[model samples]
Target: METKKGNFSNDNTMESIQKLTEQDAKTFLNLIYAILKDNEIPSEKLISQVLSVYEKKIPRLVKARQDNN
Candidate 1:
């Protein structure tokens, strides 16, 4: 399977809020909100943090899903 990387825009963020079914997305959003609330930082750094977490989680999440099946 070819995995396509998603490009998220400000508009796409709103769409994701409506469309994402996976729990990880919800957890990530919560973490982002917490990070924003806890610190005053540039938006670039905040986005980088969220992307880093998502990258770290993907392999582990795929493995867990395969195990369950």
Candidate 2:
């Protein structure tokens, strides 16, 4: 199921977070691309960093999302 208020999805996923507004997903993607290019990092390196980040942030994110719901 989905919720169409603005651009956000009610489901639990990164896509849902990105869908917070119509421009959210695009902005998130552009920001990631810009960071990768600016730091000269490979996609794999970015994935590694993302994993490291997820480890630290997923719990907080989950809580935040649940609170929002």
Top candidate (lDDT):
1
Tens-digit lDDT track of model 1 for 1-69: 213554344454444344444686677668767877866768888777766545544434554665777
Clashes of each: 0, 0
Query: Model 1, residue 54: what's the lDDT?
Result: 50
Tens-digit lDDT track of model 2 for 35-67: 566666777887765543333234345457568
In Å, residue 25's CA in model 1 sits off its true spot by 2.2
CA RMSD of each candidate after superposition = 5.9, 9.2
Cα RMSD of predicted structure 1 = 5.9
